[model samples]
Target: MEQLMEYLLHYVWQHRLYGLAPLATTDGQAVDVIDPGVHNLVNSGPDFFNAKVKINGMLWAGNVEVHERSSDWFRHHHDTDAAYNNVVLHIVSAADAEVRTADGKQLPQMVLSVPDYLQHNYQALIDEETYPPCYRIIPHVPPLTVHNWLSRLTVERLESKTDRVQQYLHRTGGDWERAFFITLARNFGFGTNAQAFEQWALTIDPQQIGKHRDDVFQVEAFFMGQAGLLDDTLVKAERRDSYYMRLKSEYAFLQHKFGLTPISHAQWRFGRLRPQNFPHVRLSQLARLYSERRADFSLLTETSSLDALRALFRIGVTNYWRTHYAFGEESRESDKTLQTSSLNLLLINTVSPLLFACGRQRMDEDLAERAFALLEQLPAERNYITRCWERAGIKAAHAADSQALIQLRQHYCDGKDCLRCQFGALYLKQGRS
Candidate 1:
């Protein structure tokens, strides 16, 4: 077993799963645990702080230390560290040595008695090959339990996204509009090209783009040019269409005027992607969005209804893009408008998180609530993780549920952090019963 299994021992101790039978120290003195104390500490001290226990009818309250073996106390140099001076109890899986404080006072030691079934169950979980070790038991868990867990997970997922938004805000010197633009640009890539898009956004100064926001053509030229899509060699070797020529010329003037450098065109991925989602097409749509909305995306956060948010993102690329997915390649006439699914994705991954972060920064609960409410208004995402949940009989009804499942899969299930997950804890608790 990995050394981290000690965390499972910590979990068992915290929950008092060692049964109600009278406990004893290695010396055979009767013992009782009144309180297991706080196990989660931000700073280093003891494994658990401020514990209350009764030994031989005497109540003692102090810090508690835990280890896989009692000798770890010395191996960890607690014998010389004055920080462990007041430890009242030493709980270890095996008591192989005597422990003492810096003052030479022998500390009481107890061999934590975990139930046999709990040990077997934990071993079975760790040895299981499935994504979620307890997948077989998921369907058996109470629906209310699953529902409550998912709700909490949804908040956790949103908070995680909001954390990234805060990082962007910090990098942009707390400029909300610039941060939102960066986030929106990143999300416009959907998934395959998200990093490249984010890198592109970081390179371009949003203030420069704001200057030409009134002119869609100029905005498109600037964005496409900075993306390196209007490379002289590539554009020249291709069709050299009139629109392409204009963008090349405009970008040449803007490049020198602003001292701008374009990102490598190779950063974008086109493998297996639909033409509508091509970098060229998405950049055009993003240009139109900026031209229409300008630097003020506060309207996105202030919207009262989901429909209003949907309407705000209901934009399409220019007429030239309607026939061309790339700079020169002409295609059949089709409306390259943002589809409902793509719009929902952008709202979920970009707009909602941005609004949530704004609300948190500005202390506006209504905006954060609206951000969460918007997720509930959209359909659940269909992805591999969600499919796994569905196979386990946990069907998501909305984006909130889908996001929560993603959090659970990525953070808890995949990491094998069952000891910290409520659902995993519930399953283990049921097994003990």
Candidate 2:
């Protein structure tokens, strides 16, 4: 029950979801919450920062700490930490014990009662079997409200992706080109092999590959060999894949020359994947792009049109991959390349985020605007999530809307964290009028 209280208290306090009545601290001093303060997601000092409140007709500005019970303050040892010294108000569902600062000054404590409507409405939303908890209210929500909320969710989703790119830049020691490659590689693997591709990218040095960029075969040898695809154990053992042996031999020489070690073969997942999505095909296409200077970040940012970006990522695998999905196994000869849908996905997931991250780091507003334009230019993704939202009366008009829906499904819906979601807030406010 305490855990449940802790979960709901934070959002309730932030949203001011309490009865409209005069309030006072446990010691009978008047208190009025002005701003509940910013919810601290990343830091350790306080649950909220820079809160505003009026205590006994005096305006007090400080941080706020909240919990299921007031005794949790000492249980968490905030009283001994100097960081808690600035916390002017301790809000809890129950004032179980007196809290103090490191200097032993008793802190003002306020008990916030849970509104019965919120608890009942939240429970109903959770109990509902619909894809979106607030689907019933969705149709009633003003179109403008839906539009504004989706716009915010879209930017939030993009910003989250941007944070990932920034971390890559940090890990790559501020090398934008290397960071872009890793980001593209992960997206190239798209569904199943994304993690394996990222691990594979981290092992290979981008600068070392640049030296042999003139030769596509050398690049293939480096990429395939480093991915552990050339290993004898992974190939279908019945047929001796000569092309595999050839690349293995070449990679042997290159591996010796560059002092490189391949990632373990066990890392790659193959079951249930299509022929085109196999590591060999995708990695070969990547090798082609890298060797041909097509995947260069500087050139990509200079591209201005959606068609131009499509052409940039529309790379085909080398001749060997064109004939086979795996080493040693030959299939019908066909032109194997990124299809239109695949190209769109690459643009939506990889290209836009890269542009946004580059724009922010370089302080170029054009680049940031380009990121938004790219999403706006693309069609909505045809997936279960979009279909689900469409069933809920919220069809995605573009990639931005689809991405926002996906974000909502993943972050808010999956966690049942409706208290922090706007849609949930509206559903809870029903019948209050």
Candidate 3:
């Protein structure tokens, strides 16, 4: 007998992928599968429920329990469990032994073997080295299939982010502005220091920052101070840099007044990051946005154009950041402006989702449609997932396509959960009726 997972048997039974001729119980009663029942996604009591079958010309309807072998019914104690009493049939790959209900009634049993091609195809997915084990078939897949699945995946990706947005709202006491602040802050970390940025965002009193929001310098003080970046060590290192001294001194006074505590400076990551992306610089740029642009939540809900949203995040860093990547280290004066590409990323990862979430919360379909429209208009994001998809005979044309590809990579490819993936399902169903 071939080694098998019970899930594969469930897949076989649910899809009616078994010997086409006929089936019989252990006692040789003629059998026919009417319906295999719904597969229990929650993995509850029964493997499947509401099944219908015919045995010895009698119609029976109830739950179904599948196992690699009928003996597992006993090994798992289902024989004595009342949950199995309603099972009209026990389907297994092997009929190792008989199964009886808790009331001592023998249940009908049928042996179902996996089609050799299906097992071979599934094993190739599991054993293949490259991602998307179905790479070979991607080009040949119907274009309509690819389009529809990607469309569904893009919405799924957006919905998943909406949950995180709701979490931020819960943390902010239903304050949309503060929730947006935290979400945008996390994205400012640009992947490496995102967690640290989110942690820092939670530490600040958004109202207190709002009070001093007019002064960009004070905003920098609050931002850097809460990030735990304005230390005495920085003051000492940049003793001659008056900018560093001013931020540190102002932060101390504000910290005492607001009863604020900062996240450990160690939380910010610097290794392998460019000077422009350093936490210190990004934090400064964000501070400028708060004081100058104020990036109101209303902007996201009302703003729909790619250009308009990009302009919103284009708030450049103050002069201090224009010359320094770190507290003490003064580098050549650079523009220090948020690049168009980085702006696009912030729009894709932060703004669009924020808009969609606002729509969902407000029950305004227009805002949600605007969110989708934004991605459709923007260029595709260049990232590992998109690159891999490009290599596998598909290329993303815009942010929507790229976002779907990203969802596919994270939710399916990474987990090898191809059994649930639309593309994976198509790949498996190839050549089958």
Candidate 4:
């Protein structure tokens, strides 16, 4: 599932529901059918009208090309009645032979005629292994439409973020301080390192660490000690040894100063990652960020972009980390810069949602917009869910569609509740009328 999310965005974007023909009365009055082609008219779903659609003055709707055999509709028991009665159209991408309704009514069948434009667009997105469709799709999307769509998406993204933050507030019994600590911890490693960081925080006592803020060294010691970097004397053989030794003594003094509990054997992994990304270093940086910036959660609402958020988090590492990755000083340059990508992930996963959550509480539009603008500039995400649609022959034209597809899949397809998705229902109504 973790791996799938990494590439699902692109797949879902391509499979987005295109528009369907709207229902109409013989006298031209619009009639809402069991399933309307609402999304299709918006160019967001399969291009068929629906079951029970009137073609050439005759009411017709039935399945087109759902994967199973025609009889499977009966096997799935659509023959049992209501599903059959409203079906005016039948659509299929492929068919073994002709199909009919359970009552022996001859249904109008329509095979999908995926536009050449759609096919070409889809093929272009999936062929490359690196650099997702963003670069390619960006050129094709109209600049005007891009801005308009992003403006809307930015709002939607922020609203969603705000909702999550509210829930966190409730879950934590409305303690802003605890929430801030959690938020800081979450930002420590961004997405990939977030869970580990959270676990590290959970194992350490917050009260013990909170009291030592006056001496920033004590705060640094608590975090490093909690991270288990001060355990071995042999670890001192490296240049970082001196730094860790000082931090260990400082933490010991601070722990006694504030009755702090020592950290246990918490799991931290450095394998397959660059040295700069080590959990120990990241935890140190996180502590430093908090010590340097003493603002309430609401202060972040004022930040305009992910870069601004990064600037907030960019407290220089302790004197030790400046010279060494673990405990050894290096002759060569070790990357001390916080990764922008990691910060972006923090905005996407933690900051944006939390900011939006805060905005909802205060009903602040500025906070919402600020959080959303950060998301808009992020490169379009690609994932398995998006690829499935790409394989099915639709293409993502922009980040707006990609995010929408992700939302659709997470909220609709995975739930097997197409009725909730305007696009999915439109697709099913046409594709499996």
For residues 176-213, could you state the per-residue lDDT of candidate 4 as single tens digits? 66676676675666456666676666555556665666
Task: State the lDDT at 377 in candidate 4.
Answer: 66
Model 3 / residue 78 / CA error / Å: 5.9
Per-residue CA lDDT of model 2 for 286-325, tens digit only, reads 9998999988889888888988889888888899877888
Highest lDDT model number: 2
* Alpha-carbon lDDT, every model: 0.85, 0.88, 0.85, 0.54
Q: Give me the overall lDDT of model 2.
A: 0.88
Worst 10 residues of 3 by lDDT: 232-241
| lDDT score for residue 189 of model 2 | 88
Model 1 Cα lDDT, one tens digit per residue, 192-236: 999999989887787687788899999999999999889876665
Model 2 ranges with Cα > 4 A deviation:
none
Worst 10 residues of 1 by lDDT: 1-10
Model 2: which residue pairs collide?
Answer: 241-328
Candidate 4 stretches with Cα past 4 Å from truth are 1-173, 202-211, 233-240, 294-296, 305-307, 329-331, 381-423, 431-433
Tell me how far candidate 2 lies from the true structure as C-alpha RMSD in angstroms: 1.6
Per-model TM values vs. the true structure: 0.89, 0.96, 0.89, 0.56
